[model samples]
Target chain A: MRTEAGPPVTVVVGAGLVGASIGHALTGAGWRVHLVDAVPSHAMVAAGLGAGTAEPAEPSEVGLVVVAVPPRTIADVVGESLQTYPYATVTDVGSVKAGVLDALWERPVDLTRYVGSHPMAGSHHSGPVTADGDLFVDRTWVVTPHRKSAEASTARVVELVRACRARLVTLDVDDHDAAVARVSHLPHLVSVLMAGHLTDVPEEDLVLAGQGLRDVTRIAGGDPGLWQQIVRANATAVLRELRQVAVSLDRLITAVETAPTDEAPADLSLSRELERGVDGTRRIPGKHGSAAVPYEQVVVAIPDEPGALARLFGDVEAAGVNVEDIAIEHDASRQVGYLTLSVQPERAEGLAVVMRDGGWTVV
Target chain B: MRTEAGPPVTVVVGAGLVGASIGHALTGAGWRVHLVDAVPSHAMVAAGLGAGTAEPAEPSEVGLVVVAVPPRTIADVVGESLQTYPYATVTDVGSVKAGVLDALWERPVDLTRYVGSHPMAGSHHSGPVTADGDLFVDRTWVVTPHRKSAEASTARVVELVRACRARLVTLDVDDHDAAVARVSHLPHLVSVLMAGHLTDVPEEDLVLAGQGLRDVTRIAGGDPGLWQQIVRANATAVLRELRQVAVSLDRLITAVETAPTDEAPADLSLSRELERGVDGTRRIPGKHGSAAVPYEQVVVAIPDEPGALARLFGDVEAAGVNVEDIAIEHDASRQVGYLTLSVQPERAEGLAVVMRDGGWTVV
Candidate 1:
């Protein structure tokens, strides 16, 4: 990490969630931050929220200029920021980097001072009101340095990531787009397609929906205008994955249609695809980039009253067992909830016994 | 609703999750449930768990016979059960009703004695070990009686659902298959297709997975064999939905690829699909078959120590605000978690004020 005598002065362009959040984190870190936005009220709102001071950029004194504009306007804004703040290293926080870099390449702009970065953190809500100072903490922030980028510029971007307390991952622009296409863009569209089916469904049928349907379609509730831009920005990569899904879906349809008869031998193709699904799920990293570990879950019945959860947690804490994770499931009709606690496999039985003995219902 | 002086004795076949859960609920409701399975060990395990007694069915005295076998064997098993217990009403709790009914249509069995029912309740786990008596509570149980079925058989099935505290929805066999095909089968395949794309993904890319991908692909982690059976059993209905999805995916690809240029007008199709997704998600019942009410979420930063969550909940309770729901998000690297409490919209500000005044960080 680069050590400085005082907090670095940084200039933030755009007062959206990403930009505001970056300002909030840097301000809380003792940085002198200036926020500028085309929409004056947005900048004022972000400033009021303690993100930064709503003011023009101090071009000469600024050490870093961060552009957190939408994908379509990123290149133009980055070009202007670089020209205005000639002494400062400039970077952008756009979802797609390769397209922006290509757009910049078309302009007569200096590329050596620019590094493209994307903090892989977001919420369903948009704008600065949903901004949190700790949004990027412990989240991966991808830094994509073009071939023309200077070593010093790359170093400055890394320092900025460190100041925001985010894990740094280095990738080329193309590689970054492809990775997000698989992990983010593809899943997003899949959610949309699944949820779109519900558009014409009868209300009576939808009443039977369960947790499985809910989980699959939760992300479909995001803003369409923003997502359209994202999908369009990375169209090539996303289209590639979408075609792969189409082919897989076709094969599954065939497999289901030609499933084995009672007297015939079983077909391995269907099982093969499902096993592949299992394999893919296993590859997702759990907390802290670790393999997904299996935890024994102990479900405790708790009333819907406010103090019930507190009492249950107190009882669990008294047992000296650590709770790894928790999920609260409510039975709407009964107004009762099941608090599922995940703990070390060996400790589950002990924890359940303790909770049950303490007058709690453990299932 | 039908009323009886005492809880009716019900015999459950196939001691799996659904079967054993039914047994557990019925037994808890004062029913004498006999548990049987081709696999003797499964029945014995269900018996040990107090789901029911491991014994042969007393056909002459049985009031109801529930066939909870896999979809492929449901018809055959239901036929044998109806023949064995001539006086008892027979029902099979299979995921797909039409396929089972069609199979029975080809047999010489008495269709008037059978009722095809499906309880839309399941978990990722299978078998009796993961069974819970409360699984069916607040869940929808569909009863699709055949055209040749008598009213008495349907009434018995309705009483069974009432004993398990499940909501009842009656639909024709074809309608039930189509409804589940749209809601359950389509989502499952979509999850499978998305997850299959991850089969060959680089581990580095998979590490960037977030809650969005986790939620979208969660159902993909289920048993492949069981899912294959489910998809195949409802092939016609599932294939129809799958084909519709294929057309939708194609349109989405075209929309993304041909997105509006800077000088061109914005495309309406992409935005339309996304808007439809939003509308669909809005229609899902929030709790207790009520409209999806939006709750205000307040996030609190808590230490990872033993009593930190308990203390936070206690503080919230002391403020006298009811927590509608809670989601605990842990930043594993930092060992800190954000406990997000959802409350009534009108009470959020007051709750935040109280908690902040009590030395808690509320965001």
Candidate 2:
């Protein structure tokens, strides 16, 4: 991503969200990024957005080549990039890894220059137009280097992650696939299945929907064609996780079907499933790889007017609390709304006191 | 809940989050609220939070009695409230309406005054301490009036919902349960199943977790005991939804299990499922019960210093864009982070220009 002379020279193949994001970040850092794509307009569009310039004549100058393409085509693209860009370290932004490695097993390519990496950062929104240079900042980026990968090449991939301002997590290629299957791919399909239930539901019935259903279904809006490739690419690991989920579903179904209207069974499998979910959430690492810190919200009634949020948040800043997040409970028809400021658990009371004394209603 | 001469008088029983929230909302509307609970200390805490005063002896003066007890106890408490408070319209905020109505069928109490309501607003944060009067503002509150419910009683319940500033959706008791089964109960279980998959996963593997996983599993952390009661109370409808989800899960599992690593089948059931998911998300009503508006995010990189957010958002407001929501991406060790401002899709470009012109880095 960066070089000793001016900036790193690299070739970004496939001008999509991930690729254009990389190109944008690298160009902003003064890198000479050569953007290329099978669809010529895609590369041109990314270049027009200042992600990078058109493919340069001197391909051998690129110190690194990032293959950002569809999962089904990643191996072929990576293979071609390695063959075409001699002396360059080759990496990719593919979500899944083992399939690419399996596809590359018999290919007559130099494996020493190849290191596989997956930036855990992504959005349901796709295409170059949705790209942002800061998308990967502070996000966990998993780098997987196979046994045949040279140490120098892996280091280069590591630098790519660091240059993007992303946190790096290293694992073997197969381990990366399995971990992503459970953490990313499995949860994705879970979202998809839940959303599938919604397609046939009556629209009038949807008024009952709240934040919970919205949260559970939000990621189901990702491009279906791309997801089809991802699911198929990581089929083995994904299938393993999916089967386990199937087991839980059957158990929960039985629990609900036989549940008595008068009283819950003494041995409540339903409660057990809900409890297990709590434990599962606990397993997710918090920011900076720490235990998840639970933040509490201090709801304040903010008048529906301009500059209201600024004045309120200014007071929150004056209270000397680092607001972790904020949510505005809004409706088109409401004149008064609530703004929930998420702060450290221990600081909520002090912040609430300051706001209340400052002529604010702390709900 | 309000009367002509003074604020309307009402009794809110069960001082949990929902109950205390009702007490808080009603009290803020200038109504005299009486809070009671099986655990008297809970009622006292809610009273301490200014939700209401402790229950008074003269309950007959109240126009409405809100039974906010647990689902299993809702029938008994509601029946008792009707018997105790003559001339008061009795309603309960049990999530499942059918079970409560079924339980009240053989009671000697006057069924004429009883109505079932479910306020869709909630948080994983529990207890009276987490209650806010604005919690129900703009939230959909369903009023389920059975055949036995009198118009006067239903009107009083609707007034309670209005007093809380909640949007009202009236349905038959059975229809209410069925709708909630699809929209609320089913999604809850899907989240539970997804989160349950994480429970046994290695902590190291969880480093790959992202916002999508956090969102999908969030409601899974709700009180297991309460969820157990809710699932049992709405068993029949929930069982039907669960059976269908199980069917979808089976189909999805089959698709993934047989997905060839080399090439996908001509008839891609996987893609079909993903497409179905996209269609389902379209069904979710957006703000003010309209079609979900696709908000676009304009990410800006901001220095990690106090007052940066206040100033940045101040400009956003000045730029004539209403921020639908905001998210800050942070890690323990970053000096700079990204703040994504969500705006109407059409206004994104204009906001970005205004931001950049104002010396902000619109990434």
What residue runs in model 1 are displaced by over 4 Å at the alpha carbon? A1-8, A125-131, A262-264, A331-335, B1-8, B124-130, B330-334
- Determine the iRMS, in angstroms, of model 2: 2.5
- TM-score of chain A considered alone, across all candidate predictions: 0.92, 0.87
Candidate 2 structure quality by residue, lDDT tens digits, A1-363: 234554457899989889999988888777778999999999999999999998563766778999998887899999998888887899999999988888887899998999999987655434324677877777778899998999989988888898888888899988888988988889889999999999877777787777678889988888888888888888899999998898889988877766544464464677788899888877776655667888888888887666677788778778888777666655433445667777789999999999999998786
Docking class of 2: medium
lDDT of each: 0.83, 0.82
lDDT of 2: 0.82
DockQ of each: 0.60, 0.58
Report the Cα lDDT for residue A348, model 2.
90
Any residue pairs clashing in model 2, and if so which?
B2-B8, B3-B8
Mind giving the per-residue lDDT tens digits that candidate 1 earns over A1-363? 223556557889998888999999999988888999989899999999999999776577777889998777888999998888877789999888888888888677779989999987754433213577877888789999999999988998998899999989999999999999999889989999889888878887777676678889988988888888888789889888888888888887787677686676576777787888877787787766678888878888787776898788889888988887887765334445678888888998899889989997675
Interface RMSD values, listed in order for every candidate: 2.2, 2.5
Best by lDDT: 1
Query: In candidate 1, which residue pairs get closer than 3 Å at backbone N, Cα or C atoms, i.e. clash?
Result: none
